[model samples]
Target chain A: MKIDLENLTIKKAHEAMKNGGFSARELAQAYLNNIDKDLNAFIVVFDDVLEQADEADKRFKDGTAELLTGIPIAVKNNILIKGKKTTAGSKILENYKATYDATVIKRLKEKGVVFIGGTNLDEFAMGSSTENSAFGVTKNPHDKTRVPGGSSGGSAVAVASNYALVALGSETGGSIRQPASFCGVVGLKSTYGAVSRYGAAALGSSLDQISPLGKNIEDVEIVFDCIKGEDKMDSTSIPDKIYKEAEKDVNENKKIIGIPRHFLKEGIDKEVLENFENSVNKFKELGYKIKEIELPNIEYSLAIYYILMPSEASTNLARYDGMRFGFLKEGENLLGDYMKTKGEGFGKEVRRRIILGTYVLSAGYYDAYYNKAQVLRKMIRKEILKAFENVDAIITPTTPTPAFKIGERTKDPVQMYLADIFTVPANITNIPAISIPSGFVNMDGKELPLGLQIMTPHMQEKLLFKISREVLS
Target chain B: MEIKDIENLAKLSRIELSDDEKKELLGEMDSILGFVEQIQKVETGENVSEAGDLVNVMRSDEDTHESGVFTDDILAEVPKVENGFVKVKKIL
Candidate 1:
């Protein structure tokens, strides 16, 4: 059997490099080889893979390697890749190259991290499944027929399929974690603004966080440490403050893990609930106290998120007119060209969201929809603040169900939106959430991964890691 | 709620939906809007929803910020360009 990097954590990969077993080029090439044929996971697998691999290999040989020097990483397309076509999986930007290295990409490059390629995502990180991508749908490696949970679908799938050892995935809601859970990999979405969003294709600016998807939690942590720092490029980035309270050893502690009793009330699949309970039981086995807690405003998160997220998406996506950087329509008038480019270029889901966003943010309904959601958005934040005060970290299912059949929910917008229900609460709160794979679905005897979303207080990422490591191990 | 509402919304969103699509969406969006309306019933307080807590994040007016480097070439690749500016279709 080929040596699967899925079994090799980042720490182990670093050790192998230290031992001279495989050079970084060989490691990166191995992943490239694995993604052969119908992996169907990448929008455009980097053409510059060999070049980056060679650079990483040289750095490894010179002994000037950072912790993740040799580990090949995929960056989500929405995040800037300098000259690469950073489409965010929308046709309008099918040719628009980024002007500057997004703050995260710049930092990672400085640390000797070789960016293998940009992974696909929902247009502007707007949807639950990668199907919303205008380029194409990214298939789950575990099961090709099912949808890879998105909008960070390509990022999670890249790591899961061992195409890249780690990938940077941005989450507005569970774009990173939900997809990571479905792909059976570890994904971390740091606190809102914890990672810089300087060059990412904006979704909900309030909720956007550029996080990491890795083969394991250790790999995720390594990438996080390298990229998680303030940058002048991102005005929203927070100054690094080592929170003392998070330094407490949580290996065997019996701290409160809040379970939002209302979160799983509706549309939860049987297998997901079973897997989630099994995960909680494992945490209990690890001696962590599980408390049935009430996040009262959690139910409204979906309603609030669809309104607020789309509102921001509308404004952010307005920059993608055909005339400037993207695929311009061949027409006479400006409005005609704009209409043709967007009408043909955008996918059904992206158009739907833009419409929803524009409707809510429009003059008459702005207060009724967008402004009301914002007021309730703070209420959701307050609910999390209150809940976290009572409990150290909150535990919930990352998504309602595991990977569904590719076309199962596509026809129904409500069903499609429901996939984001459990994940949207975290976006509402701007808290740190990590989805570590929690066993499998026993129903079909197929391995469908469940995401156990562990949310901690803002910037308490160390504590999130501590609990996540304990639970995952 | 009405075809007119969907039409109005479509115009606001800048997407041109056909009459048939508008008719279908008006019925569907009625339910979606009905669902959102329930949240307005929940008690909330005056809170300005801001993206981040960081305030006064303005750059200094000093000349030291720019190092006269523009190698990324983002502007050069624009599909329509003219004299260091991204050119767009003619505006009325």
Candidate 2:
């Protein structure tokens, strides 16, 4: 039977399997056949994919299948699946295999989701484009000359290109949302601590969140619900009681959306601005009120992210010395061995960030860079929370522009960083945010996708999902 | 930022770079630092407390898994493993 890969959602697939329209193996094979090698979306298409689908088929046969049973999903390479090679898109750990599963991977495995493959990412989730990947860049499915945004570029491509039903991506700053915007998909970055981080490669410990990207809002929400919860393995994971308490404060009648017009004054593409205004008008037509709000300290969000992320990243990356694991290069002495191994193993962007991180945390500069950024981070979070008191959710264009060409911003690190300007504030404040495909813009004679980002107060993912559904519908 | 500062950072980060690479990094790091320098200009006022509440989560000290269950698996990824120990260069 021919499955409609483009319109397939988790619900539709599940109902089809239950009604014997097609077996799990047949559905999985349809997606497997759709995987295109030219896109470079996957680092490794798992050899055991069919075997995993066969197991899901058994669940359906035994009347024990759950909603996620037989669903084929792509995972970001930074996320570890036990006994699989988990390179966070760096040469250092290119051959290293995970010894255990990440908490999210374990949960999905329990739900009978088929592990399709490990998708490519920026090394340590550092860069804004997948161009930094040691394995070649993932091209935007819409236009092969353009890049799929990163560091979750590969996962976003997997969903957008119909290679998988849904995909998991990790975000530190704009990693997940930016790519989803570029690929015209729905991406959700759950509130910090809403999902467990254990067994995922650490980039920025304070900022990283495992997220989901899919073809639409409901599919993203379904995958999020299956994987989110407090875990004993992750101390930062928020307990259910906190989410329960936060749910009490949710005003069901609130329909006012806040747009920080001051933040959108410059650097945004004219077409993207027009699309954003149209999205706002659509909301107004749907009986929702739109208000111009001010977040006074939001301009510093990118600066704070650069300081805090690299500081944490350098500290986190210190573990990859020659003796323990990963690539090793011997030298005349111990220090030389460490230097040679790291110098040769890490890519240019990874090395640059590590050095930047080290400099910020170094003795004389620590107070000036790292500590000041932290204090400002607090101010930004407070300002955002204050805005939430007057608004239901804050909205913005997911990115300043559409998917850029592969090598357009590679030479200029600052230009690449600016791509994330609109998306970083959510990560800075640890709020729940999502990017949904709003519309398209004709760039260079190609209609590229643009995304609308909606952010709610911390742990308010349900509100984001509700508003996202309204916008998309 | 100076070339000497870049050298110092390389030494501190334990990543060796060629002289040409170091020269290239010097320019790149300068721009990146300049971009992030906006934070230093913000008047954070008197109260400079860090963001978010810090809480100490405690759990009983006990073995959650069987001893040595993952010893081989952990050692398998090591670059050099010898007789159940990770082999490394002599410090002295």
Name the candidate that leads on DockQ: 2
Give lDDT tens digits, candidate 1, residues B11-52. Answer: 665566667777767666766677677788887756564665
lDDT by residue for model 2 (A1-473), tens: 78999999999999999899898899889999999999999998999889999999999999999999999999999999999989899899999899999999999999999999999998888888899999989999999999999999999999999889999999999999999999999999999999999989999999999989999888999999999999988998999998889878777677999999999998999999999999999999999999899999899999899999989989999998878888999999899999999999999998999999999999999889988898898899989999988899999999999999999999999999999999999998999999999989998889899999999999888888988888788
| Chain A of model 2 scored by TM-score | 0.99
- Evaluated at residue B55, the lDDT of candidate 1 is 69
How close to the true structure is residue A67 of candidate 1, measured as C-alpha lDDT?
80
**DockQ of every model listed?**
0.54, 0.78
Question: Estimated TM-score per prediction?
Answer: 0.93, 0.98
Candidate 1 is scored at a TM of 0.93
For TM-score, the strongest prediction is 2
Clash number for each model:
0, 0
For candidate 1, list the clashing residue pairs, or say none.
none
Q: Name model 1 segments beyond 4 Å from true.
A: A242-254, A443-445, B45-54, B61-72, B82-85
Give, for candidate 2 chain A, the lowest lDDT window spanning 10 residues: A245-254
Docking class of 2: medium
